[model samples]
Target: MSTPWHIQRMAALDFEASDKDSETARIVSCALILVGGNLPTDTRTWLVNPGIPQEPGAIAVHKLTDEHLAEHGAPAEQAVPEIAKSVAEVVAGGVPLVGHNLGGYDLNLLDRECRRHLGDSLEGIVRQPLTRVIDTMVLDRQVAPYRKRVSEEQGPYQMRTTAETYGLPWNEEQAHGAEYDALMSARAAYKMGAIAHTPYRDRPDWVRALRTNRFNSLRGVTVEELHERQIEWYRRDAEGYQAWLRDAAKSKEKHDPEAVIPTAWPLRPVPAPRNGGDR
Candidate 1:
């Protein structure tokens, strides 16, 4: 008898690209597909030749040189099919497709790449739709909606720091690279699964509802209104509050001609001296 679908393992995909605007950026990097519930007993990765030259800036960040890729990586077309097949098999067998941020980036990129690769021969087997993508980004954002003491200018937002909010220690240096990203993604999902299995799991659902409303509401607003909302939101944040207060205290006459007045203001008091007595 065949193994039950539930007995089959679910998989997670972790992908990184050089540029969000390019095709390669849409479907690049290594993947870690696991073969179990939440955590996998086995994982695998694939290196893809994005079919375009890796941008110098992107290459600098990822260190995936085109020269090395040309020698070691599989072509995008060849690699994508294999990836799709693997993902489909797992999903069809009743396992969820998990990724760090599959809903926002990785899955869409891979889907695009797979569609591009399947070309005319796209059929029910290879080109059919897949389901149950568990997005770690959505999960993390659900846990902590509005709390960033400091925003990072670099690194995967969904991976390193976000994991920390959940009491999961994520080492960016040790956990970078596509393979590691997927592994960590799986780890994050496993952690989430534990919560989802708990009494407080309803909290994530409530947050999801709020995010859905926020996203839908954003789509209804004007671009200018959206910008204002974002600015207002940031202004309410710790970093934003500091900036808002700093600008507010500045003289209108001394305001930079190039800068616009922010719509929101902060009310934070200055911190007291560390010593008991003022210096």
Candidate 2:
């Protein structure tokens, strides 16, 4: 017997890549942690051999090197498709794939990887209703827009900062590993929901202030409804950002030549940069 989607789990996703380029970075690893039921359980992690040289800066983050992956990682064709299928199966079963910064980065790479290998995006392979997603970074902003940030490390509402804000456990040693980051994202997502569901009076003073949050609308909502809300939120966010960019460009007489805000809601597909052969 399976738990209902509403009561089942929200999955948190994270990926580490071989470069910083959103369009060209080859994904080195991807991880997802299911957050309902027992939570921090039902996790999946994939280490992929992108068959490309890793940028030094990227190595500084996840620490996976060409030498390391050549020995431990599966070929892109083998690993990317398998991972996509696994995620699609869960999505088809009504699990919402959640993540921090996923819409902007990880999913874009996933789309390209899937197309690069299987000639299909992850959603196309699912061949069912589109998978739902909850972006922790996106939603956190809507929930608490005025949180202070005095430094790069504090980051205001960034994933790591959000975890700290919610008093969730974090391990610096395991911080950048996809599995660890995904787990932290899952916990942060749950913490957001906790704030939404808990009554104001009984909560701690800090949480009590969020009693009037936009996320309050999520309480008792169905998985489908929560998914819909995120779409609406993302649309508003993208348009607002684009408008700001336009205003800035007019003032500076220079714009993001492309000036395109990825309005694909949860996971925008970025085109792969020019390459002779990336196989």
Candidate 3:
């Protein structure tokens, strides 16, 4: 059988933002890593001066201080458009975009940044739906729905944790840096592709331990088909989680029944302007 598209080529994208709120967060740094083919990985990165105060918590994670960014980072107006153009070019070339929590976070943040600065969302710039995406987080959750947090130090689906799970090297010092995170996600994707394509009998003990047959469904699929599968997988997972939250709320547990998990894949919809007019 032919190689899976993810095993052949992918453009891994990541962004470090001003804060965790994707709707309001500004891009502080971003990276895109092109993997596969005979050539070495091509990495492009940008640091942006968001021209706003970053949350201290966000600063602690990515370590890009407002003072430092103001002095050295490119203006967001310039950086955001360049980032969008670069990603659009890669997507137009039919390469799948890979990242951890891409649909739930990075892509949504990028769309916000583009609309805030460039007056267009990334989808608007690309002029098409982002259908070629491989979200390592979504894939991992789908394949190993029962994976549990091994310790207080890490969440099971964090990029570093996922990298470790997949047998890739991890550097704590580089964990939150956009470039490093993007590269690690790409490496994890390669490993996941290997697992999916490898015969079950030949798979390692860890693969067998996953206790799920989902990887078998991934074998031999085109990138577009895999992308479509993730959309459904993510939607189902979100619905399940939302339902669990409602059940907890009904039981008088401390969960929010009103909490909603977005089912969008690759990019979430842009919120309407608060003033009831064009943003």
Candidate 4:
């Protein structure tokens, strides 16, 4: 049998934004890294002058300040389209796009930025659902729903912690950089493919300790099939989380009962304008 698509060539994508709001955040930095087979690894990065102030909390996380971006970054109108075209080229070539939490965050942010700056979304350019994308976070949650947090400092499914869980190298100094994070997520996806494709008895003791057979079913599936499976997995996960938030609200916790989690995979729908203009 041929190698699984997940274990083959992939283009890893990541983006750093001005803030945490996917609908409104502007892209501060973005990266794409292509690696696999006998080809030499290729990497591209962009820093955009978002034309907006960077939030203090976002600055602390990515360390790209307003002054720095103003001096060194490309205008959003220029950078956003170039970034979208690079990603479109990757998808057009049949290589999967790998990232951590891309469905919920980065891709949604990119879509909004493209619409904001270029008047066309990434989905508009691709002309299809991003079915060739692989989200390491979604895959990890599906495969290891019972895994516990490593410590107070790191959540169970954070990219850093997930990389560590897969025995990939970690560099604290480079942790949140767009290129570094994208490469780490790609490596993690490669490791996941290894775990999934390996035979049950042949898997390492550490793999056995994960204590689930979820990866077994993932073995040998086509990328499109995997994408469909993730849609279901993500929906179920969101429903469960929404239910938990409702329960928390009933118990007088700080959670909002009316908060709705979107179940869209890879890209979310654009919010309608307040005046009811076409989205």
Summarize candidate 3's per-residue lDDT along 231-262 as a digit string, tens digits: 99989988887877777745366577787877
Q: What number of backbone clashes does candidate 4 have, counting pairs of residues 3 or more apart or in separate chains?
A: 0
Regions more than 4 Å wrong, model 3: 249-254, 275-279
| Worst-scoring 10-residue span by lDDT in model 2 | 1-10
* Cα-based TM-score, every candidate: 0.61, 0.85, 0.94, 0.94
lDDT of each: 0.55, 0.76, 0.87, 0.87
> Which regions of candidate 2 deviate over 4 angstroms?
1-7, 38-40, 210-212, 248-258, 269-279
What ranking of all candidate models by TM-score puts the best one first? 3, 4, 2, 1
lDDT of 3 at 197: 81
Per residue, candidate 2 scores C-alpha lDDT tens digits across 26-111 of 88998977777655577788898999898999999888989999999999889988888887877877778877877767777787
Evaluate candidate 1 by giving its C-alpha RMSD to the native, one decimal.
15.1
Ranked candidates (lDDT, high to low)? 3, 4, 2, 1
Per-residue lDDT value at 43 in model 3: 85
- On the 0 to 100 scale, the lDDT of residue 220 in model 3 is 80
Candidate 3 lowest-lDDT run of ten: 248-257
Instruction: Give one digit per residue, the lDDT tens place, for model 4 in 1-279.
Output: 876866688899999999999987899999999988658899999999999997899999999999999999999989998999999899888888889998879999988877887788787876666888789999999887767888888899999989998899899999899999999999998888888888878876777777665887578888888888888888988887777777774536657778688888877777768797643
Predict model 3's lDDT versus the native.
0.87
Per-residue CA lDDT of model 1 for 44-160, tens digit only, reads 678878777766877776678888877888888788788777766765565666666565556545555655667422224344444345556654544446445445563334477
- Residue 180 displacement in candidate 1 (angstroms): 1.0
Q: What is the lDDT of residue 189 in candidate 4?
A: 88
Candidate 2: the clashing residue pairs are none
